[model samples]
Target: MRARRTPEPYLWLLFSGGGVVAALLLPVLVLIFGVLAPLGVIEPPPAARVRALLDPLLVRLALAAVVGLCLFHAAHRIRFTVEEMTRGGRLDVVLAPLCYGAALTGTVIAVLVLF
Candidate 1:
């Protein structure tokens, strides 16, 4: 008998990596941009300053990674939730590709937009 390989390990790795990135960075980003800045508790950086910050290649890469990983995290969660809801029915075949595909599409858009 031939050994069968499964994509589950790789998927789970992406899921875990995304979870870590989201956990560590997303809250701080939200607190800074979504809450404090918007509420005027903290002064928002000037548009030119923001643009300058993003002008660095490293900064752009970091932003892309954060956005891409977060999207993958969301996709993984939604995929499992959908699978559980449907009790692993006929939708099983389509769910993985659909979920991961959306993640990849979002990642590409993020890269393009960031660059």
Candidate 2:
């Protein structure tokens, strides 16, 4: 028996969407536990150790990578959405470079912020 291979475009869509959902939700969850609960107004959740997240160098690299990849992922997803809505003409030409350019800019900003 042979396994089926999914198309690359669909796979990228799924991965990008999932990553966005996770990234968005995580901050909310963190705020709920880290700040809200600590104020004693909301029910408190158990604390989890985040020692690794506290390292400045590691944090900067991680933030930079996250920002860059996320922007690229977002660009692809948004471009597709725009394509569906507008339906044609030079979309790829305009969007592809913009996406890459934004990602590169984010990477440079991250490097500056980190350093």
Candidate 3:
């Protein structure tokens, strides 16, 4: 008799946990920092400076982080969707590249805005 092995469900659980955390944190962080901070609603000791405090490098870095995480998360979700809707597994091969490509496109746009 051969021994049976069950894959760990915790991997998916962790991924889901991290994804949800990022999804929630990203938008809230943006709204607070980008909108509220600019509007002068929430003030810290330094008194949340407006756009005057931002630099091009910081903006581009923020854009890249948001874009990269969103693109990766979206790609995984889309892959799962395709898998559920179809009976074949061929689509899995292209999911990663497609997602990365979208991320790269966003990064390029961000870079362009920075310059």
Candidate 4:
């Protein structure tokens, strides 16, 4: 009999990609936009400039992708961490759907907001 395909690998790929993107992009983003800008260590972009930056379809898509992947990474981490912490072998049955469902929902919201 042929073995049925499992989604675990695909999910892990997303988790890994998300982690990398979050690690690489998020800190710099926070540093520039959240910390330095607010503390006046760096001048923030003007509102019109920000709007201009977001005017490109590619920029919006990239932003949406980053948000979506990060959400997926978070979901995967939360699911496995909770499962491990509880030492409950059966938790995967309940956790996977909830975690991934939330990620999917967030991705949808990001797309809608971006577009």
Give one clash count per candidate, in the order shown.
0, 0, 0, 0
Encode model 2's per-residue lDDT on 1-115: one tens digit a residue: 7878745565376448647755876588668877888888787744443444535677767666666666666666676677678885468778666755776687688778666
* lDDT of model 3 at position 60: 58
Between which residue pairs do clashes occur in model 2?
Answer: none
Across residues 1-115, which tens digit of lDDT does each residue of candidate 1 receive?
8879988888888889999999999898899889999999999978998899899999999999888888888988999899889788577689889999999999999998887
lDDT by residue for model 3 over 1-115, one digit each (tens)?
8967733353345346548757777788778878887788876325345344444667657656655556555655666777678864777568646754675687577667655
**Which of the predicted structures, 1 or 2, would earn the higher lDDT when compared with the native?**
1
lDDT score, candidate 1: 0.90
lDDT tens readout by residue for model 4, 63-113: 999999999999999999999999976999889999999999999999998
Angstrom error at residue 14, model 1: 0.8
TM-score computed on alpha carbons, candidate 1: 0.89
RMSD in angstroms, all models? 1.9, 7.7, 7.2, 2.1
**Model 4 ranges with Cα > 4 A deviation:** 1-4
Where is model 4 poorest over a 10-residue stretch in terms of lDDT?
A: 87-96
lDDT of 2: 0.66
Give me the candidate number with maximum lDDT: 4
